[model samples]
Target: MLQSRLFMNLKGIGISFVPRYFFQINLSKIFNEILKYNTKELEEIQVRVRYYNKINQFFTPTEKEKIGKFPFKKTSYAFDAYEISKYFKDKFLWNKDFNDVKWTFKDPTICKSRPLENNKNNILLKLDKNRHFCFLKDDLIFENKKDIAVFRGAVYQTHRKEFFHSYFNKTFCNIGDTSKEASQYRKNFLSKKEQMGYKFIISLEGNDVASNLKWAMSSNSLVLAPKMTCETWFMEGALKPNYHFALIDNENLAQVIDHFRTYPKEAQEIIHNAHKYIKQFLDKKKEFHIGILVLAKYFYYSKQLDLNELGYEREILELIK
Candidate 1:
């Protein structure tokens, strides 16, 4: 206990140390049992499981060596992957060193990728999980909040800058650039609770997928977002425009807002659908199952783990079917 506390304090000061046994959970037996039970709940978990880990190759040792190993403690982003890898009793080549890169990996590697770049090899995991996976509680109903839409975030990306330049002055929207570099466009930062006061919240992609998307969808307010160029464990690609969020670009921001404001029932439907989409992520037990399954599939395909070692390879085949 003393050693653990000391290590934590050292981590707080930017000195990082990861004890080898920290990620070993001995939960594979329990996980296998969960997989053995074929039910509606497990079916839902498998959908997300398939979405995260798409590797379907049998890589030789030589090919796996060429992919190169990424340092685990290089960043907090890599930490999630490192911890998960050890959870399954092995490690593999992975990259959590960068974000929003538009290239796909040729050899099997466990990493995140843009939606368009997502192929069988670029295995996705919930890296940087805290920043990307938050959900907010909202009590305000759509009919009761201010009708104006709100957008407050750093304005560095080309698309973000374009949206700010075009719609920041619009009457129906309250938008601001929060980056120091975008001082001229910057406005006071609005907390998540503060942003929920308005009826619509803009979710724009930054670096990769929009980090705000999960919470924005969880809120009572409707989300205003363009077509997603990237995706994560949230599976942004599956979201239907006009159903989950009102699709908006600079040209149609006002028009879409006007239509939704005038027809609140329609806006309420979008909110309902958004809430439905958010429900899948709310179950912590199923989420753990899905994460384990994703890693299981990843390791299995890469030839790291044997068929019997997963304890339910047949069950995985059936669940995936």
Candidate 2:
């Protein structure tokens, strides 16, 4: 229900972002306009509008990722990556890959040594899209929260996990096991809002820069995280050390905790700074803009697409570059 409503509201925003120079009236526009009117309420919508000689794929996230399709085992990481391919696409093109889509809201595959683009300044940072986007609850009690940290997820594969309660006393942290049943696991899960009941939260690197890092940034808790070898949409050029999340090590976690406990003001300040930065930086509005820009670049640089036809698309790509 929430998604249905947001999809409808977002179309107007999408339309306003498009300039009038892209199309002059024609039979296609007439039909497109009629189709738009007929399907007033829907799970999603797909429409293409042309202005002059230029064309834009409306409802399209990016042309790069949408270009190919392949199958894998049930437990494959591609299973999740495959679902993400639907981020933006015409419902009818569900079978297709997001072609010329050089990037996405979050790529499941990235590491620090190998950056996406050669130019650091020109690299486009995207926000990790929450498939279950919803309004976060606001009833959390910030003042009377737990002093210890909490972690609840798959053991996933990563080293330097001494911070996961192995090195810390259980009184100060709780890194639970992974094999609980769905309902029971959910029962133990610390929700985005409920996590406010903690003074400290450990942000360890999972298969990628842990998604929890972003939530931790928005929360009122101090994030104790090590330098991430795996990068994500928000990590590359966005986060800073000692500002967004504290730099911790596999050893001496007790000392790290003691230091923060001694200087509580500094810990609070770090949390406050990260909260402010992420709140402003990862706004949903900007996420939408970045998604579109990625598509524009894929079209502009892709040899697969006829480059001549995408001449006007270069304007948007230029700004992104």
Candidate 3:
């Protein structure tokens, strides 16, 4: 009778019914049977259970140092500038002013010849001794020299090959703008790169988080997942598209790619598997429903109980039903 009541309650909740006898069996007895002769089975079961639990855990604050050492130096410098601006305001302001002055002065006098007596020997010497030094103007006065040094220091501090590549090489695609012109442009750009034998990866951005992730799965390419620091609306926008590459934010691209490259081989294989799964399941209604169901399970599990928190669970359940 108790088993029947439980099954009836589950059915009323729209869950499919299972045989009542399955629930009637003592769970403790089953567990003991599984562990009877296998001492290692308990440890293996614990590891898997813990792993699944961890996967459902809500986002916890983690120190960068705790995440493991990164393989590549950070590729983005924008955050470095932001960090410096925050803690060293005065120094940052001074550097900014110096950069403005140096660029304002040096750009106009790049090709002008000087008199033999006033040849740029001193400037050449400074350049030779310190590659960072450059003359802002011919006079090389204290103000000019100070400006040049400050600007040069900032430039040198920001210079990193990975940083430049992340900023310029990664492309951002917008699904809303996938007109004929945009399609042709992307086709041509990709063709040119292919012709040159340059490898590339694609990412998609959408208006819904799950949708954005779904699009990433569709691409079969490595993704640079968005950070929580980005605007929520923009993140949502990135997730709404069904068939687009993951759209990497300019600032986060370098960090994400670096993270992926440094990931353990097992992790990399899992990511590759996810990509393949996405590709194989794309446009399949049954798979889409399954994805939603899996997402709901994680969402509810993260909240520590079976109750729905996001309303997405109810929405998806309705759709699936």
Which candidate tops TM-score? 1
Superposed model 2: Cα runs more than 4 Å off: 1-128, 131-143, 158-165, 180-189, 304-314
Cα shift from native, residue 114, model 2 (Å): 7.2
The candidates, ranked best first by lDDT, are 1, 2, 3
Across 112-158, the per-residue lDDT of candidate 3 in tens digits comes to 11121222110100001011111111121111111100000011112
Candidate 2 on 120-222: residue-level lDDT in tens?
A: 2122223224422232333443445677766666653536344443553355666654535432223255556656577777777655456577666667678
Q: For candidate 1, lDDT tens digit of each residue in 264-319?
A: 99988999999999888887667666766777675566566665664666767555
lDDT of each: 0.72, 0.45, 0.26
> Candidate 2 or 3, higher lDDT?
2
Candidate 3 to truth, TM:
0.23
lDDT of 1 at 175: 91
Determine the C-alpha RMSD for candidate 3 after optimal superposition of all C-alphas. Answer: 27.3
Error of model 2, residue 169, in angstroms:
4.3
User: Which residue segments of model 3 deviate by more than 4 Å?
Assistant: 1-22, 26-29, 32-41, 48-171, 174-219, 228-321
TM-scores for all predictions: 0.86, 0.57, 0.23
